[model samples]
Target: MLDIYEFSAVFPSGTEIYSQNVQHTIRSNRRTLGGSLFFDKLLAQLHVKSVSESRPPSANRGYLYPPSKDGNLEELHDKIVSAEIADHYKQSLLYYLLKDCTALDDEEAAETFAKKSHLSHKYWIVIQGLWNLDHLQFEAALEYLTHPSLLPAFPEDILRVLIDHGKLANKHLPLAYYNAVRPPLTNPDLQKSYVTYLAHLSLIQAYFFIETQPVQDHKSLFELLIDDALQHSRSDGSSNVVDELINLPLTAEQEAWFEEYLLEGKGRTYHAARDTVVARRLALGKYAEAIEAGQQLSGRRFNDINWDGIKDMVATSLGSRVEVDSVFNVAEI
Candidate 1:
């Protein structure tokens, strides 16, 4: 049995013409052309003709036939056909067709596709493309970055690269995307160690760009650092106090309190707090303070305090011990 479908085709003149299509064969029946294929071919021919006639008079226009549009139409038809054969084939064909579409870099393309396609799929494609771009195109990157669907998939490497390139104009991108995605830190120690590194990069970028001070999301940042310290802290070993404190934006009162705490008893204050404060200063490479603190901590009264043990922990935490000797008298402190 034949099925007929009808719709109105609108013209540039603001007039609509009613049209009907007849399907003459079933899926099981042999056919010259499937109903959908026939309609797709007709549409393609009409679109190509329309585009060809719209070009302005120019020498290059002769060679600029609408073949590109026709090719895309054919690709779309093949994708639809492949989708019916297998689920995997459908995904593959769709990915291939949409993967390299430079048109998607345009605003109209983003808007149209966002409205018509499954947003999740479009977001994945755009994010993948952005990751694959060697030199990021800011506009294209922004298109995907701003897409609500894409934010959750933004990769950490891309975020790092963006910060390195000095393009993270808005601090909120990292704040928002990290909160949403929260990529697992593979190496907890390494990740914890780099908090200051990332923060310093962000600070430098902020200074260079003259951007506003980052909103001090101190609660979250400090929580992360505290967790890191607790995770890596050994009861017998010196604490990685510097890693915990350096990234923290201390208030004047807090800084003053630390200063007083470290300097209280004719330098005996630092000796008493050596295990805690020296461990921290060493983590931050505050070598001079570490030497002074270590000397006081290593005095005859505190000889059993294990100065070598403390130094070894600091070296391991910092990934190098070369500067440890310069900071303290190895024989005495």
Candidate 2:
């Protein structure tokens, strides 16, 4: 057994090398095992050390039993002592000790090893949480991974897994997990995936969540959120989500971002995206700008209904539906 000092020298903390090694080792465990491969592998390593090393025959064996003199003993020896398995064993010893202690039915030896290893318990919890994910136990994974005590780590990787592989009944596991953990993702790809998921799940929630993000990221996430909403909306203007998005009480900065995204950014592909922006302007009581935008739009959802008629219709709808103090006073229009 390697001492804690030797282990620390081999795997320095807070390095990319250590993080990748832990991730690789956890992902290597076979998902088919009902119980932990950690315990079984540890037992095999102890058995190999007992037989191969020059230990005295009278040494305390603890829970290990002497193998019967049979062909099975040789086969087990050959399998556990292989170079590939031994290297993996070295990488996984710390991870295994952590898992064993956190298991529902704990092992005292594993706890003892964990104490001796002197690894951070938070790091151990994170690895165990990810191990649960590798096995497709999402609920159990979330319970530990999303706990308030744990600071976010490996956030983008975890988000990718949940978004790509979660098979919950509602298909909202990614959104749920993100809401609970709120990991600050720096990768553009993962940020796009996460916000796209959130937009499709709940436009209002996505809007509010975007409000809390960094101002630099707000425009991109908002643009993606609006593009996703527009893409999924029916051309005939039937999506309640579209209505919710258009009617959102946006801040002045958000309103400018929304207009720029639809009028000049990636939201231009959809036929009704511009018209949706005009409707939003109308909802925000920018009647003059709404009419100007309507005239500039090359494609309109209602080509036959003139801008004046559309304005009257929108004003009527807002008068009946919107609260006087919440949005704008209809009388002002």
Compose the digit string of candidate 2's lDDT tens values, residues 281-304: 777778657655765554234334
lDDT winner: 2
Q: Which runs of model 1 end up more than 4 angstroms from their true locations?
A: 1-135, 138-151, 163-176, 187-196, 201-333
For all predicted structures, in order, the TM-scores are: 0.30, 0.56
On a 0 to 1 TM-score scale, where does candidate 2 land against the true structure? 0.56
**Cα RMSDs, all models:** 18.7, 12.9
Clashes of each: 1, 0
Q: List candidate 2 stretches off by more than 4 Å.
A: 1-127, 167-170, 234-238, 296-333
For candidate 1, what is the TM-score? 0.30
Cα lDDT for residue 62, candidate 1: 21
Question: Clashes in model 2: which pairs?
Answer: none
For candidate 1, what's the RMSD?
A: 18.7
Residue 88 miss distance in model 1 (angstroms): 12
List, residue by residue over 1-333, the lDDT tens digit for candidate 1.
100010011001222111111011111111221122212232343332212334442422321221244333343434344332443333322332333333333224333333344345654555444523332343345445545555333355444544433144553444444444555544444243335334443432222221221334333333343333333343334333434444444556544444454455222233334455565566557756765666545432222445676667666755667776556445534
Best by TM-score: 2
